[model samples]
Target: MSGQVRNTTKIVFIGAGSAAFGVSFFQDLFATDELAGSTLTLVDTDPAALDRMAGLARVLNAATDRNLVIEHTTDRRAALDGAGFVINSVAIDRNRLWQLDFEIPKKHGVRHTLGENGGPGGLFFTLRTLPLIFDFARDVAELCPDALFINFSNPESRIVLALAKHTDVKVLGLCHGIFLARWFVCQILGRAEAEVEVAGAGLNHFQWLTHVREAATGRDLYPELRTREKAHDPAFTPLTRRLFHSFGLWPTCSDDHMGEYLPYGWEGGEHGFDFAGDDKNREYLKTLIDDVASGAKPVPDDWLKPSWGERAVAVIGGVLHNRHRYIESGIVCNRGAIPNLPPDLAVEVPLLVDAGGVHPVSLGPLPDAIAKLLHVQASVQQLAVEAAVHASKEIALQALLIDPVITSTDAAVALLDELWEINRPFIRPCV
Candidate 1:
């Protein structure tokens, strides 16, 4: 892999302070041999957080012998110049704000499963997030126009659509949901995850698996998957099982994410993300980082191992080496890629990556029944993107009213008024 790259590249991470993503990203980056000697810049708003990640990166860099030229700063503009790749995972006040996003809607009688990626909550997230991301893209366009923008942000579909419609930053959204789905399929079949192959495409979290087969023989496995899924525990992934039964296409991801799109999502769970558990995990990770970075503990072997689901480093390596690699899944604009969906809508599908760019592999047309379900989301997403880009509260209201998860116009109005105020400090025109 190192032999394939002819020149060193500069890579930038816009929100590199995150405990989970920062460490995981460094792990993948250090494990890739081809990326050695590349200049890696970490940018974040929080100076202390940035310093901690920098310390960890230094420890990893020394341990792995990757010879990476590491840099850290709070100023993204200073870091963006001459960068070949920009990876962003910025979530403004992530947990605190998301809690409000869920609670406010529920208080207004809107029962949502996970408010991060759908419903009125998703609308507000779009409002708050799109402006900041567009600002980052704007800087990239001015400083390093050729850099590939890889995003790991939530409200994945909305962020991709907004960037595609309003900016020219050459963006792609990545998520591990598809891998989770593959694991789910393998679980039902009682086989190792490596033994089965699954392909799905739709919205980011709400993708439908169209092909399920044995990787060894390319044998169709969906029929047997259905049989085993029925006989298996009814308690596991109940929403996904029901959807697979009704639509004949298995949905990837679990209940919380898939439930975001439907009005009946409360059937999965009315409670939102587990902030308490997440807080605990965040603290544990911080301690681990402190210990490892300060030489109080030895580096974990797993930290130096290659990650299976993360595709950012794989993409960088592919583009640098001009390797036309087949990526399992990525988010990009749908220009007849799905045929039935709107041409401008952003859809998640397989990708082919090379020096030219990231190209969305056309899944052709989805099943009619499935397409029907996605059509509504397409409209809602379109409106939400418009609302966010223009900073139009009226359009935001319309987006919420049209959403399937938003049952009552009155509740939509109340939820919007409350959430819009809560996110007012972050909301702005992306243009």
Candidate 2:
């Protein structure tokens, strides 16, 4: 389970001001013995938010048995010094800008249901955020060149692509989509989630389950999965069923998210997530900030139990402890992982993470049909990366026009105009 365990390791969180993610990540750090005694550096833009989360991290560290070193700063460079793993989940006005990421495309006559990771919205989201992300990556490249640069931001594939292409840092974009594939198989088979082994590959939100087998017997379960979907498909996953019916392989993630890539996504799909809960969660974090700053509410004792998913934490542990582990799916440059897709394009595929670092595992080739569907997205994402880094409106327009959803040239121009004027402040001349 171990290759090289560092006597002292540093894990820095880029967006520790995010309450839900910060809280859950704190829980994960406490739960992992592999990272015990390592220092945690928290970075964020908001000072008061930093003050609040710093208090919570201290409270959690005191309650835990591990000798966790906790520090907070708005200066990312100050935090990146000698970091082993740089975990990033920073968002620029998440709920508010996410609303813009969704609605702006719809205004341009794009029939998109979910704009988070597909359509023009995803492109714009990548454009706005990568500037900030690349800034962090540049510092990491200079300060902690060997650190595993991990991103938990949205439009995971595009972000990884931008960093991969623009920065010297090799990045890995981790998403929960890979786990959903296993859950989908288990649900179809009427088995416990732990009983199903699934292999999936595609874009981040648009991955497909290529293999499903029973864990104990190594029996193929795709036939039975098809049979169940034919008899009674779940309404909750209509888009997945639709793609599976056409392409003959179940896709990972939910209908709304999968709907983002398809042209007819708006017919019976959602445009974006109901961030009402997210909004409430942000407000709750605000309250917690006040409570922590005012010394009323302390860090919850139950976080010691750590009930959140272990995707990011596992990668953190794998590198820091040299515990080579197989991650179900992580986004990285193709490097021939999928022969059908471009070698330079970032794709979500399984990988073995260890002392050698996060290596992209070969997943053979996707069916021509699936490859064709993802290729368009790969192009749009690449163009978006170019547009963001170079500040090219022409490139951004080309990306939107190339996007399957925004086919009309006139519409693309009009849409970009509106989106540009609206997000002018944040986008800041980054076309």
Candidate 3:
């Protein structure tokens, strides 16, 4: 495998309205020499968003002096044709509907730490989004059968697993959970961006770093991280401080965001962000829409810069340059990838990706407790995918019930009912 273009690759971004992510990914794609001749298709329902993304792509292409051919479309099928890779990043207008996901759950006396993942909100999101994903998958099967599908949406592992079990499309899920793991280690060690050694493996947003050591001394940093939280700044929450003390494990996500997923983190006045705070999420969405509609704001410097999303770039680079790079990706259905989990399940693990193709490394079985927790979440994801494929409201309800954040059966049922009612217009009925 040498750095040579064996074939022209077509990469499609499913939701180009997500300019922040699109810009980041496109910049990374443009930076790599292997991706220079690839065709990038930006697909979005919103014409304005697609236009904005086109502007960004042009700026990036000019800056990098890359010959990456850029295309934009609102039709999924048109954008998907002959694509070698597809990346999904769509969200169902959270500002307008996410409040319904949160409010209805709270009405039933169910609390969620974050509405986006691991709760009723996430379930509803899955319900709404999975149908679209399956629609894309079906099209990919028919039109781009040999292409690799990469999901960048939330509940990534579940989504990928659902697709793998239900469709023939080659799929992988990806997230920045590892970046958060690095941030957690840095916070614990009180170091200002020191080089460190770390190893993490597990489901998205739930992976734990089993090893954290100083790069210089090879000294284990976990023990010191365990003890020092007590003396650290009071800005950190007690739930987080205690989690570090008890689990002897620092979580990949922050306390404010992580609290919603775990039961004990938010019980009895525990310090955490309110689950109903859709203010920021809504504001960001509004800003994006407004900027696109009015063209009144200046693009941020960050938007003009490049990013390091490794998967797409690595694949393109490998295919183009024949440079084999190891990337941690959530690939579906490798028998030995994770020892204890069902071989059919999609597992997030490190894989050696190069010009030849993607390969998953077997991390062996996860610890029993972690595997148990992941199994629960994975079940919800699987069920959600099934619901989308079959259009079964019952399966969607079951997925919500299986969710760890929704403890009470009655609450789960109620939230499910509300979501069904709210999302009835968007969801295709299960046959």
Candidate 4:
């Protein structure tokens, strides 16, 4: 492995203040000798968070026995110069802003179990962040023309699509959706640890596994999963239990988080589902900010754990060793990835990743039932990206009205108006 190493690559992480993900990705990057002399730049607007991450990077670099050049910057453009790969992990102010994302929708009669994935909340977030992402894309075009942009931000597919449609930068969206799906498979199999083969493709947060098989044998795993659900295991999380009961299909994401993405989960008044009054998003953001600001070690339980974010590591490994590994990733453009969807829409699918770059596999067309749901969410993502690039409130409103959670035109309009007013300071002006 050491002798198979190739040229070092410059990896720049935007929003390095995000401790949980930043630390995990950095550690994963440092683990391989292939990246021994690589340049690692951490960029963030928050000085306190940057400083803490810088310190953590130093310790990890030394511990890994790698001569990695770790640097920190408050300015994103400065950090991106001459980089080969750029990872975006940014979020708006954690607690206060996220609370608004979750709470304001409730006032407008829109319910969202997960505030950040897909809903009025997710749409508003994309509206505010897309402009900033495109700004970075423009800079990358000028400074790092050949860089591979990996976006880990919320509204993942929308952001990637914005870059693909509006900019020339080579971009791929990264999320832990597949990893969560694997976790569910593991739980359902009743094995402490089991290797399962799964394939899924769709827009972010809406991805569905088409097949689940046991790696050791050629046997299908879906039947076993269905049986486990029938037995009613209390160990299954609330969301999974509810999904099995209602949808007759187990979901890949947690119950609370999956609610915002699916039309049935939050809308159907069954299994005691409550989208409003869920403070987990707020608490998670607060915990993250405090963790990074106070130099808090090992993120709190309230925050998302980063153990499952393996794309960065996988990317680096593939590049360094010229080894191909298949992982499901959210990327812009259909291009035969999902046969049933439009060729231009962004879809998250399994890809063959290597030094050559990511190539998404075609899952053919999704079942019409799933495609309809995906189409609704994908439209919102497309419109939000358009709104950001053009700075058009009308496009943003279009995105809101098309969102699954907002049922009526009046409800959609009211929610859009409130979001527009509340987020005015953050939204970029329409040109």
Candidate 5:
């Protein structure tokens, strides 16, 4: 399939309005000729936001002479009938609910660094988001079973686990976490960015960096990382450095995320994460979407910075061209990819994407100690998914107990009651 062009490829964007994600997803499509002429169907429940992104798609494509076929809808079932790839990046009042996700956990005396990915807050966020995810997966099963379901939703690993384990729909989660691994390598080595290669396997937000080498020389960089971490400043990445010192392997994420899974995650408390600031940025993006579309705010002349494009477009392009590209990390069901993690768990590992579809690069086996640490949380994630799939409050309570932050059954009960009461309208139980 090398150099092949699927001119009529249909790629659907679900939750494009609730902002599961939207059309700049196609910046890569516009840049690559092979997929430039493909069809894009945008599905979002919000007509206003959907229309705004559709308008921006026209603005972007019009700048490129409009080679792609673009359409928008509030109906996902209608759009799913023929899409070759269904990318899900849905957010429902993400900023507001996310603020709740962070605050309510704090109120229950559970401090988490990043509430969206781990800890009790992660479980709550999963409960709110997974129902919508199940809806999309169920619809895909009925309408486009052959379509590859690529998710960019939060609690990424858990959502993938739920869909992969419960539904027969093919699914994977994509995140920029690996790029963070690459960036940290460059920072520690004092080298140019993207000049290093690193790999590890574990649940998303909890991956360990197994090795680091020079992209050009293939020289192992682990020794240097260890030396630096041994004397690293507590102010820089205390939790991450502490993990490296204790685990004998470099972890791939910052304390902001890695801390989420650790008991001492709230060590720095208000000093560590900036959820409020992050919500402000999300608000800016929301406002900018409308502003950019209406010409009230100009799209940055340099907005198309080279990122992994959230990995969806890159994987699609790689498969279309049979490029056999090595994506440093992708979230997929274990399926023996790590040989140690449960096959139903979502593990972030290196992958090869090409004509045959995406394939996980086996990490052989993670160190027993690292596996031990992750399995604790993997158990929590597995139960969380089951809770969401069955909408079983009993399972949900069990997941909360498995969370490292829930020190007492009393705290778990208080947190669950508070969260359920607050999120009642948003959470829809499938059972």
Candidate 6:
């Protein structure tokens, strides 16, 4: 379990072309000494994009002197054979489709905060994403049955729930939202991030911080956190601040993400996602990758360092070498992890990862009022998955109607039809 130990496990990266994921992922791989001799297969539908990342990976491999066996392919099935780990972060036509996911719902009079993880946006995301996810699960089940499937897709709770409900793949969904929670606490408590410990359990975008303490002293910091929060600037994280007061448990993530699950989420803002900004960032990263890979620019020192915040590679190392470390957060099936929530629901909670695999840490029960709110989302997410799996128009409509963000049945019908038309080509009946 020492950092000096090396393993030759075959690790497959599906959707390796993603500029956002590829850079941090490769950095993490290069930084892990135990995985130095491992086989890394990069798979993507776009050959050119895959080649670019493969080039970047090779550059990092040589620079770090890790001796990793690097491979790339557009065909995922070819890369799946005998793989011990599969990391997936695929998005279908990301920005263009996401723009519609935001605009079309607003056009129907559905007021939402963020269109990616909850509200009408979340329903459409589940619809557009699940068909492909099911296909990936089927492939993993057949080709590499024992490989740990690490998912980094959005609509995290819904995706994890769908995969857990329908597939036999050993799956785990990882997100950086918990770090957002830790950051918020550190900013408020005037403590460094490493000095504060925070844990939460709920749906992905809507987790509540049930445990917040000073890491050094094991002292509860929530009492002081509440005191400082009341006098703090009202404009900063206003919606989350309000929710913490109302629910008596601080909501994790930020205003936009936390706002997704509430009807009054528009109080945060309705400006929607900045796709242009994202596009610009992606292009810049692509250029940087090409420069490093083609030797036009030197391999950046950051590329040789570990990922900024991602935990997937750390989980892979833990499972590979039996390092029983506590992972801050992971998306997993509830299964009584939270006593009040449905066992089938996917809840974000602290995890214990080691050779036995990822285990969800029980935080007992949340407050009754908070549980009521999450229960509604749990039902909505369940219906959303069912709608996607069957491609059932009726079920999809039911999901929209029951959602708190949708006020009008007529609008729900209109939004569903319009969004469905856009995503129809990608959605297929798993049953």
The candidates, ranked best first by lDDT, are 1, 6, 2, 5, 4, 3
lDDT comparing candidate 4 with the true structure: 0.72
* True-vs-predicted CA distance for residue 304, candidate 5, Å: 3.7
Tell me the tens digit of each residue's lDDT in model 2 across 1-431.
47854566888898888888777787887776777788989988898778778887787777777778888999889899999889999887777777876876676667887678888878778777877887788889899999888899888888888777767886999887767767766777788987888888888888888889888899999888878767675674676777888989888787777778877777547546778987887897779756764668765566776644448788877865678899888999887998999988989998898878898888789999999989878888888888888767788888888888886788788878877676666564322
RMSD of each: 1.4, 2.7, 3.9, 4.4, 2.6, 1.6
lDDT of 5: 0.78
Better of 2 and 6 by lDDT: 6
Write down the TM-score of every candidate.
Answer: 0.98, 0.93, 0.85, 0.86, 0.92, 0.97
Q: In candidate 6, how many clashes are counted?
A: 0
Clashing pairs in 4: 239-255, 339-364, 340-365
Summarize candidate 3's per-residue lDDT along 1-431 as a digit string, tens digits: 58643456889999887855675686577656666677989999999778877766766676577878989899999988899888888877755676677677878988666566667776777677777787888899999998888788765665776777767888877776666667656775777545776665655666656677887999997777767766777665556556555555565556645565566545523222343455566457556645643556654545444564446666556644556776755445646677766676666677777666677866666677667756666666666667766668788777777667767988888778777888887787422
- Candidate 4 per-residue lDDT, tens place, 1-431, comes to 56764578788999988866775686566666767788989999989778877776776666567898989999888888899889888877644666677777777777667577677777878878877787788889899998888888877877877777767888888887777877777776875434777777777766777777888886888888878766756655666566556544455556656667766556432223233443565346446555644556553332233245467767656755677877656566777778777777888888777878777877778777777767777777777777776778788778777777777788778777877787777788422
Q: Ranking by TM-score, best first?
A: 1, 6, 2, 5, 4, 3
5 or 6: which has the higher TM-score?
6
How many steric overlaps does candidate 4 have?
3
Candidate 5 per-residue lDDT over residues 1-431, each given as its tens digit: 89864545788988777522453474555555666788888888889878977887766766666478889988789999988899888876777777777777777777677677887778878888888888888889899988889898788898888888778888878888767867876776787766788888887878888878888999998887767655655676666776777888878677778778877877635343465787677567778777877888766554443235367778887876788988878899898999887877899988999888889999789999999888898998988878776777788899989888677788788878888777777677743
lDDT-better candidate, 2 vs 4: 2
lDDT of 3 at 56: 68
- lDDT per residue for candidate 6 within 231-312, as digits (tens), equals 8888888888888888899898888888898899999888888999999999999998899888999988877888756998
lDDT string, candidate 1, 1-431, tens digits:
55564567999998999989887788899997878899999999999889889999999999999999999999899999999999999999999999999999889889898799999888988999999999998999999999999999988999999898888889999998899999988888999998988888898988888898899999999989988888998888888888898999988788888899998877877878999899999999989999999999998999998776888998898898888998889999998778889989999998999999898888778999999999998999999999999999999999998999998999988988888888999888889
Name model 6 segments beyond 4 Å from true: 1-5
Stretches of model 2 off by over 4 angstroms after superposition: 1-6, 285-302, 428-431
Model 2, global lDDT = 0.80
